[model samples]
Target: MKKRTRINVLLAEQPIGETVVVKGWVKSFRNNQFISLNDGSCFDSLQIVVDRDDVEEKILKQITPGAALGVKGKLIESRGKGQSVEIDAEDVIVYGPANPETYPLQPKKHSKEFLREIAHLRFRTNTFGAIFRIRHAISYAIHQFFNEQKFYYLHTPIITASDAEGAGEMFRVTTLDLDNTPKTEDGKIDFKKDFFERETHLTVSGQLEAELGALALGQVYTFGPTFRAENSNTSRHLAEFWMVEPEVAFADLEENMDLAEKMLKYIITYTLVNCSQDLQFLNDQLEKEESQKPKNERSAMSLLDRLQFCVDYDFARITYTEAIDILKKSKPNKKKKFNYIIEEWGADLQSEHERYLVEKHFKKPVILYDYPKNIKAFYMKVNEDGKTVRAMDILFPGIGEIIGGSQREENIDILLDRMKEMNIPEEELYWYLDIRKYGSCPHSGYGLGFERMVQFVTGMGNIRDVIPFPRTPGNAAF
Candidate 1:
């Protein structure tokens, strides 16, 4: 077997006049001579010059768009316009032939919605190739940033007995027959016969388990898939998505906000420097996308500018009450333009309100804290006024609420009271309560939705487009 060089390496090194073996899917075949090939190593494709007279007719006929091919060729300076180097094919081998008539991806642009329906083959397109490559870079940057900060990477259970978010939107995991479930004497369906001998569901968050690790290890983070049985069919809602949850011991809400800000800046800066080529491609793509929209609806800044703005400046920090006040005075609210109007305090601010604070009000990333206790989770620390909690949400320009976290309620009695007030059963989360009982210290953490970050970085409009296979309300197709 001959060694094959990656297209990215060959393009970068430009080993002129050297015989090399390259294998990839054909991006395009022009006039039975020029072939554009890409192997997913990078965004750019290599141009192959094939002499129609030298190559057999059968071999030439098989080199269609989307066909897999191996070519033994000599690399040389290109006479073409886009690429600096081209390959002169000495021999051609077809690994697989894609019929041009039936192949979904023809040599033409396809809509993102259409490509999503054929996600398995969408990776071959230039847009998705750049998006997924950037996705990998962002994931790497996340781990690298945490490791440098001396945080331990902890793996939490996907199927958990406790409801971390207490939202009751979890996917139930059961092995019992649903058609004829066993019932207790009182007539309620029995969960004792289930796989775990008790009720369990896919975790909505890993903060509860991560807190245990943080207490033991000082700092810990969990990056894993989280599930929610939400029936929302909007572009931003996904039934299953990735989450990055970091927990720290002996940290207050202020320190928690600082960590979240630092981590986000580090990762975004890393992607900007390391994945420059892919980011540039996506930036131009976003520019083209925005050009089609009306001037009022288009983004205020370019994609690259938006990312740089996030890294270059300190995020504007304000309280949720302050944000509500600004929204009430804003023209949109006064004119009744917002879908959910902000009439008064203690109201749960929707995405429109969040975006207004970030994009229109501050014109940069904003961090809103000290939310009303009634709107936040029971685990958040209650303030001295007793009306608000030490909760914080980091909002980005385009994507609202990129991160949500807080200083946890370390007082066992307060935790119990809050849980009871929310009607959450105490027995199910006894272990969580135990942590508060035994030598508990103030700890803080936040959960960043991984897909939302990717969407912000890549300037993708839909959350489904950021994840490889989106699990939504009625659509779970690959």
Candidate 2:
């Protein structure tokens, strides 16, 4: 028989009662009797039962956890003790042995914090592997949803000169000599002398470029890395993260919200169907971390059923004014904890308020619109109220502000005047101004943080734990 190497046989029908070869890193080893290996092919564990007299004496040390090995075996029906199937070895070949003294992983469970420190090795763990696999599945689902809807995927530039949302939270990029940085006559550092011949930074959002594409292609989305210089050390914050920005030409605020809701639902359902094993693993191993509930006791369907209900039901839409009014007059019900706090107009809603609004008040995902113009981005269309802008934030039960979208200020005169009012240099954005002069249509778009969506789907707490290599303020660990 030729050398056979297979990681997993779980996908095959009736894998047992026949001969097969197994190859993988040993996940765990027993006292010369049994071993488990994860070949990184499937979520299910493959069992390698070793009888004391069946293997060469050299095989003892080689069959340890983290060791690479291949076993040519008779595929016999499993006794169904540890697993559904077993491989009765006919020949064993040791590829490499991971030193038990140095390897961090063993049969014992490791904490997420400890695992995060060794990102390179963490993927070997069952939990991280499951999360990442689901992450990939979710990404595929997003593309599938858009592709089915005929939306084009547009590649946005990483290095952009525009502030995009005017959020000042940007990582500046420069190539001038560090020792003798160029300065203007007034002693201020001159950005004009930089490598780009002007100041530039990694994009904080892809909306601007996405808008350009949307204006041309009618509907487009940019899925790429977005950087922010904010020093927030919260579970939800990341210095560098990926964003999915979709802009639709001639789309208004209502249509934009509808698209967002449908997209989120589609992703949830997709992950549930494709990565059910991984998500179940995450829920059993990690999701209970939220409330100390055992995974087996909970039958959570990745909250897909809840979102399906949302798809069938109309999303609760409320104006900012109405939200404030409800908050001011409401009693402390289960869904209105924030109602007990001070309620006032023009005050930025806290995460607690957002959660309360969606979880307690609406008991579903809620869309709140028409934020005070001064508190909203300058690009947002001003409402008829003159004080509120056409801004919308979609808040989910556990994930607040999952999507932020708004209609653009299409009137060039008003937009230019708004820029001037904000003291923005019009000369820097002359090309952007030309878009308005060249027949701009009323457009809308939103930015959904990719990792944030994963968190909501996988129920992962920290954004750092969700991404493969998380980049945060002053922290970039391998």
Candidate 3:
């Protein structure tokens, strides 16, 4: 017998009347006659028609939801209304049996919170399956976009001696026992006795290292896992996530924004074209979810429309100072509607402010640049005005600040001064500064949280739902 054909391929190929084998977990078994099977390749499932009399009662009893089954059947037009094709089973094989009463997954609408608790089995659900499929497409498109732009994909180390963000929130990697840590003469825990002979932690961002690659190779990008030890237990934050950072040599802040805008559009367009079915599924799912919300709280646009808008229109570009001015003059700030009012030019724009700019003010994707230097990182290029850095943040509707980047400080003296001002150890980042001292030119890069991007594309409200197994504070199970 020929190997079992994946349900997605079988559904797409629709080889009518061909004898074939189909294998997957049972999604639904109706009256022990019609079996809905899914192999995870697509959102739709193949219907396996089982002859109630032909198949033994014992075998039929095992064809419950979540049970893995292999079926030898003939491809035929589905008599069902929703599906066009299905399979007529000749032989049924139970690879794995799942007790319907004991299985966590049943044919019903499960809450996102409950699904998260059983994340290991949530992949079988249509909602999560669709979200992850779109997530995969977005990730794939990121690589494709960078590759097409001739940017070399560079792999940066996960363990680093330098805190790239200067945030001091990094997961430490150590071999020393916590209970018996070695102590120096100063009575402090000695990192010299630990692994790598130095204190190291998981990387916060690959932008710093990718800058090194860009300086040498002209252009480079990194798509990898990043860690944050921040104890944020919110829908938007994840302890461990993926980031896409791209750096370009001889590029300034404007070019940086253009690249980011283009890359986002490319990835989004790619997902829209390639994953239409999945997107549609997610779009409908989102609409249903929104239907339960108050009429005033519903989104102005549907998921598909929101994604298409991102692709069809140009993102509005404004300076941070200009944005602050706009916010101050806007009704929200004037009426004290903002949670963190924009009363000054130097305060960091919170997510509420960003969403206001994108959703209320511009009504489109917006890229705000020239951030106040005091609020940004030390690596950003200080502007000619002496107050703001050459930093830019791309804000999207519904999801604010999807991309953050800046032109790097190319001058060694200025970079060193900023590092000192930020209290970052100069000795630890000596190698990073060497690039500036040796042969630095104008360079820029940005970091896009991969899950946030996925959430934006899929219309998933929670960042945890977009990632397969989200790592967050107090939750690391499976």
Best by lDDT: 1
Model 3 over residues 411-445: C-alpha lDDT tens digits?
A: 99999899889999888988899998898899999
Q: What are the TM-scores, per candidate, against the unseen true structure?
A: 0.99, 0.91, 0.99
Question: Roughly what TM-score does model 1 have, to 2 decimal places?
Answer: 0.99
lDDT of each: 0.93, 0.81, 0.92
Residue range 1-478, candidate 2, lDDT tens digits: 4655555444355465667777788888876777787787778767777776878787786778789888877676687685767777777788898888888897898888888788888888888888888889888998898899899999988999889778799988999898999899999889888888888899998887787788889999989999999989898899989999899999999998889988988888888878878777776665355356665644344454554565566678999888877666666533455544744788787777787787767878889999988888878888877899888998876778888989988888888878987877788788777878898889998888899888888777688888988888878877
What is the RMSD of candidate 1?
Answer: 1.0
Model 1, range 105-135, lDDT digits (tens) per residue?
Answer: 9988899999989999998998899889989
Backbone clashes in candidate 1 total 0
Count clashes in each candidate, considering only residues at least 3 apart in sequence or on different chains: 0, 2, 0
Model 2 lDDT on a 0 to 1 scale: 0.81
Judged by lDDT relative to the true structure, which candidate is superior, 2 or 3? 3
Query: What's the CA RMSD of model 2 in angstroms?
Result: 3.2
Ten contiguous residues with the weakest lDDT in model 2: 298-307
